[model samples]
Target chain A: MSSALPHLLVLGGARSGKSRFAQGRAEVLTGKLVYLATAQAFDDEMRQRIELHRADRSPRWSTVEAPLDLAEAITAYSTPETVVLVDCLTLWASNLMLAERDTATATEGLARSLSTARGPVILVANEVGLGIVPDNALARRFRDVAGRINQEMAAVVEEAVIMYAGLPLTLKSKG
Target chain B: MSSALPHLLVLGGARSGKSRFAQGRAEVLTGKLVYLATAQAFDDEMRQRIELHRADRSPRWSTVEAPLDLAEAITAYSTPETVVLVDCLTLWASNLMLAERDTATATEGLARSLSTARGPVILVANEVGLGIVPDNALARRFRDVAGRINQEMAAVVEEAVIMYAGLPLTLKSKG
Candidate 1:
């Protein structure tokens, strides 16, 4: 294990193995693992997916469902010895987009939370650009918002990984 | 008004009239108004502030508060005749940062949201760098995150405004 530990950003398309990759990284960092899940089981398929994820984890891992307050959750749960795995941000952004009264409120909240994260955080996100632009205005907007979110995350993170077909590609890194 | 309407981005220290300035721009865009507020007031102060903003709006203007889905909000609301004003992104970033489990999640969510916004989305963000570096790990991270958020927002935004002492300085502009 490298003595100098840094945050990790793993990006991939849907059904990609980014989550599994992040989980592996977390185990390497610490045994006291914290899984920060951003998805809410709004429907049956989602619930099943959540259940599968739950079943996959060992009882040793502590999981927290933080739909919006990521920074606070990290601060509240993480320690230098703790390894945090945030399953996905795309879903969280989608949830906020669905529920928030406005864009500014969500954006500001995200900015505030990121500035204060406490320990090593592994973030999982989607690569939305590879897909064709959606026909509807709302769909296109989701792509646009997701793109901006990715750019901001990449700017701050120490390392960025792009995963494709279950294969990981390191896009940027600082040692 | 000039055929080339200014795409103004009003930024300032918190409570430093950034929202008010953005509101003024909204007023100027009257008859063609869209107010995109990014705040989800979980506390009394924020709730009251939201209440005041609601009361302040002209009945003709359509209002939408999208916390995370900016692309959807902007596309859903934007029109050639419509002038979309996103009150603040700093808070949105903060919210995402706080709510997500780790930096990667926060960063990814943020990047996606910002890049997707459409129309004349006048953004508001906090300038967090003029002060001293935060003493602890969290504050320092927050500063770094906020700074990067601003930098990325400025890069994509057609125009950028920095408000200090209630003064608006045009940093970069397309018009």
Candidate 2:
């Protein structure tokens, strides 16, 4: 039986191997691989981290940088013969909030895009609400947004998995 | 039909409601409730936090502050007629590390104590490894140790749960 689903939401904490798990799921599909990156390299450390991620992908995979306008990027890249992997919604949410964009509108747009996407779509998001209540308002707001987005995505996705210590625990699955 | 377990390990991120869930679990047990707090009040903020936690518990519940000698405290307080709730091992781990106490030994001792404890014991720990790798060595080490201790606790506990968005997902259960 194939483990791939038309739409999959992979949730985990940082270094929870969510991206790697998403990549592995995408690799199982028989189609062109498209990586939609939401992270922006604003510092040297980030630049190096991004570079490492880029280096890990096979040359056959095409990359799309979508710090914002994630829905549009998904619409532009998704095809019946293409597997689109959005390697995180948490960063996208942060970007939208930082840009002062209405998150509800953005989230709705992304949801609509996912509903209409032509091929398999794998979305990754960090599980940020599992830690202690952040001491700052900004961090708390970020956590709330992230948690809300994860729930929204989980509701729409055909499959949902939580990664723990590099292991995947299926939270939901399509029959 | 009962959700409470004799030895439950509750793991979650900040504000993920792990502590609340643990408290609820403890409340359901039919015994004298005892709270074993591992957090240290090194500053005014922490003192306030401790006070708040203390205020949240029922006046009938006895509270024990054990920052370093957790195993000894657990041994001393746990009895057949008492339900001991340890509201976090992560802080205890930090305390042990900061005090230059041998973590491996302390962890082993704690495990032994849990194994032999007479009453029901509930542990709460932060799932710290689900995020991006910390930039500094100290943070990275803390994350590593926290993860290891969580795993160790999960192994010995009768039940293991990961709390997210105030919901508990059981990872392990007594068979």
Residues B62-140, candidate 2: write the lDDT tens digits.
9988999989998998888888888789999899899999988999999999988988888999887755556677877
* lDDT values for all models: 0.68, 0.84
Error of 2 at A167 (Å): 10
In the range B36-90, model 1's lDDT, one tens digit per residue, is 8778988775698688878977776677887766556766776667778776666
Question: Local error of candidate 2 at A168, Å?
Answer: 7.5
Q: What TM-score would chain B of candidate 1 score versus the native chain B? A: 0.79
For A1-175, candidate 2 gives per-residue lDDT tens digits of: 1235579888887788999999998887787999999999999999999999999988879999999999999999988889999978999989989999998889999999999998888999988875444557788788868876877787788888889889998877787
- The ten-residue window of minimal lDDT in model 2 chain B covers B1-10
Best by lDDT: 2
- Candidate 2 deviant stretches above 4 angstroms: A1-125, A129-175, B1-4, B55-60
